[model samples]
Target: MRYVIIGASAAGCQAAETLRRYAPGDSITLISDEFRPLYSRPLLTYLLSGEVSPDRIWLKEKDYFNRWGFTPLLGEAVVRVAPQSREVYLASKKAIPYDRLLIASGARPRLPGVPGEDLEGVYTLRNLADWQRLEAGLEGVRAVAVVGAGAVGLKAADALARRGLQVTLLARGAQPLSRVLDATAASMLMQAVGAMGIDLQRYSWPVAIRGEGGKIKSLALNHDRELPVQAALFSVGVTANVEFLEGTGLDDPGGIVVDGSLRSADPHIYAAGDCVQPHHLLTGEQWPYHIWPAAVDQGRVAGANLAGAGLRYRGLLPQNSLSLRGLKIISGGLGPHDAEDCQVMTELDERRGRYRRLVYREGRLVGLTLVGDTENAGIYMQIMAQQLPVQDLAADCRGPDFHPGLLWG
Candidate 1:
């Protein structure tokens, strides 16, 4: 058996390791457009903070290739994926045949095509190369204006502030991570980040980044506000890396569409990671989630199905976690954006910059948002996943005596 994996990021790397463990005789080829080996992406911000060197970012050292039976082709990009015929064409015009192919092509950082975006000091961080560039470029650079208020963008701001650089963050929406954190929680977060010396620019979008002599210097805002900065980073979001499968029989976009068993719409091939969208465990609706844990789980399920093992893939549950400026934030499940009459509870200490909220629908806990302390975060996720309506009931848990043990069986 031969397995050809693309992207060499979280999902693709996990699939390769799983295949090597389950079927040692299988020949594996892992390709990555990145020059370095596979790595932990969550640490990119840590790298910017000067917490670790570039060498420390690798997920596995060079010995990993020889030990795991993987033929790694680093810094190589796949130009095309012909799943109907099971062949992958490289940028160098070489084609590799495969019995099974996994398209985990990961994702590229999304950059809004505003003016001066091509300027020297402007960037969008997604890969190690991007992180390295930003770090090296920050030399003698002082103020930075980051466009986008998600985890990555805020983390970048956090890194910059720690380095004593004046950082101004801009968000198109009124709230940071509006897709994940609700308005109330986002407001609280904004207050916390503001106290830490970050200029939070909400309800603002970049119209044009003004550059002097081909280098980023100032940016024109939607509100006609111009801000000066030495550098800028746009950490908006990402789209799937599916352009290579252009002629492939897969569905639209960079990710291939897969069913409950991780089978593509074509059935002959499978796709996972940031590329593919899985059925939501709660909504039962299909959409792409660009989280690392989900991508890894998706790859594992896909690999199992490809090994001819009958494994029923339970759709993914949405969960996300983040650590910003020493404050840990974790959230899970969905709230009543469409539905009402939710039982909501909050524990807030503004002086300490701590807030926690849990929303319950009917008699079951549905969603939660926590900051400063997330030790029992996973327990809430477990309850939501299990849909358990337990001892204290929804009303009782909402009170001050909310025992932590309610999370247990």
Candidate 2:
């Protein structure tokens, strides 16, 4: 059997590996638009901050494809997929036929189409190329205006501040990470950003980017304020790369909707990663969980099913682990602020800058947010994933003395 996978990121690569292990002798081909070898996308910010070396970002070795006996088509873009013909067409007029196809094409950064967005110093940090360009252009950038307060935006602001550049973080909502974190957690994170010398502005977004001589000069905000900066970086969000599957009847506004087996509307085609929206483990809602671990899990499941293993993916659990300067935070599932049915339990140590909030529904731990202390994040995630009842351990959970042994023993 011939298997073709579109994308070389976390999901695509993991799926290819799983297929190779299950099929052994089947022909496998991995295609990626990026010329560079497979690397961790989440580490781009660390790379910019000089926290991690360039070599450390690569996920695979030089002989990865050769060792696995797979065909590596690098720097090639899939322009279209013909489901009826079972062929994948590339931009270079190359057509590859496959018995099974996996579309893990991933996503691209969403850019705010404001005026002067094409200025020289305006940038987005999505892939390795974007990071390289931004890093090179930072030589004379003293101040940077980062638009958006999501994970990407906050991380970019942190990295820029670490590089000694004045950072102005603009958030469209009233607080950073407003969609995920509760009001208290958001306040704690805001304090951390302030300690790092980043100017955190809430309820602000760019109306237009003003430039002079083709370079960024100032950013005009909706609040009738202007920020003078040499560079502007946007980390708003991402849009799935599903344009290639337009005529395949598999594309959706959120993402490609897949069943339990990760199979698309067409049985011959499967999808994983940020390009597909699977069911949520907790809420049962179908949406794209753009997390690394979710992508890896989906990829493996999809590959197994592709190889006729008949595996069913349970669902995706949305989670985020972020580090701002010295503060570490881990959030998962639905926070207390997201649902009215959730019963919240909290513990706070303002002097120590530590906080924990657990959201329970029907006596089961449905969500959690841990800041400054995340050592037990893994245990909390496991409880939520298994839908384990935590009513008896509620008191223990609210304090730092909480231990896994309490539930087990």
> Among these predicted structures, which one has the highest TM-score?
2
Error of 1 at 55 (Å): 3.2
lDDT per residue as tens, model 1, 45-123: 8888887787788887878888887898887888887766778899988888998888888878878887778898998
Each prediction's TM-score against the native? 0.93, 0.97
Q: After the best TM-score superposition of candidate 2, give how far the Cα of residue 363 lies from its true spot, in angstroms.
A: 2.5
Runs in model 1 deviating more than 4 A are 249-251, 335-341, 351-353, 389-393, 407-409
Clashing pairs in 2: none
Top lDDT hit: 2
lDDT of 2 by residue, 169-265 (tens): 9999889988789988999999889999999999998999999999999999996999999999998888899998887788675789999999999
Which 10-residue window of candidate 1 scores lowest in summed lDDT? 390-399
